[model samples]
Target: METITENQKVRAAKKLKKMFGHVDLRDTSLICPIRDVMAVASDKWSILIVLYLGYFPVLRFNELKKKVYGISNKVLSERLKHLEGDGYLKRTMYPEVPVRVEYKLTDFGHSYLQKLIELTEWAETHKNCVISNRTSYHGS
Candidate 1:
C-alpha cells in the first residue's frame, strides 16, 4: 500500500491551482457547502439508489434492498435518510396492518436521473471496449 504524504497533496493542489487558475482556498464558507452537497451525492448507495429509482419509481424498501445487492440494513437506512434530507428522494409511509414505506425520486432527483441515463447509454455503447481495455491492463 502506497502512503500519500502531505507534500504530495500540497504539490497536487498547487498543480491543480496552476492548471485551473483563480482558485480561492481562503473561501471556507463557499467550499463547505459544495463539499457537503458532494458528500451527499458521493455516498456509495446514493447514486445507485437514485439510478434504480430512475428506472423503477416508488419501490418498497425490501425491493430496493434486493435490487442493490450487498447493502446492509443500517447503511441502507442511513442512505435513505440522507437522500430524503437532501430532497433527492421522497419517502412515503402508508398506514396499514404493517407499515409500508416507499421511495421515489423527487423532481430534483429526476434531473440527476436524466444524466445517469445518458451515462448508462454511453456505457452500454462503449462497454465492450472498456472490458477489453481492463483485460489488457490486468493481463488476464
Candidate 2:
C-alpha cells in the first residue's frame, strides 16, 4: 500500500464529513442510506456489469453473462435491476420472436465509470503490495 500522509488522511476525512454532513459514528440511521446506495453500485457483480456496459455501448443479457464470467442468471438479473432502478443503467426490451433485451449505461453511469476507472487503476498499482501484505500476514 502507498503511504498516506497525515495531511492526506485529514483531507479525505474532511471531504467525507462534508459529504456525509455531520454524521455521528454511533448513529446507524444516517449511515444506512448512504451504505445502501453504495452497496448497489459497489458490489462485485454490479461493478463488473457497469464496467462491461461502459466498455461496450450496448450488450444483451447473455453477452453480459459471457463477459462478466461466472455470474448466475439470478444474480445478474438482480444486480441489473438494482442498477437500473438507481439510474446507473437502462434496460430496453424489443418485441420480437425471442423478445430481445439490451443493457447500456446512462450518463450517470458513465460519470460513475470514471470513478471506477480511477479505483481500478489504483488497485492495479497496489495489487502486488496488497498480495505481499496478505502473504506476510497469513504466514505470521
C-alpha TM-scores of all predictions: 0.72, 0.93
lDDT of each: 0.87, 0.95
Clashing pairs in 1: none
Candidate 2: regions farther than 4 A off: none
- Residue 64, candidate 1: Cα error in Å is 0.9
List clash counts for every candidate, in order: 0, 0
Candidate 1 per-residue lDDT over residues 34-126, each given as its tens digit: 689888876768878999998898899999999999999998999999999999999999998699999999999998788778877888988
Q: What does candidate 2's lDDT look like per residue over 23-108, in tens digits?
A: 78678887898899899999999999999999999999999999999999999999999999999999999999899999999999
Best by lDDT: 2
Off by over 4 Å in 1: 1-22, 25-32
Clashes of 2: 0
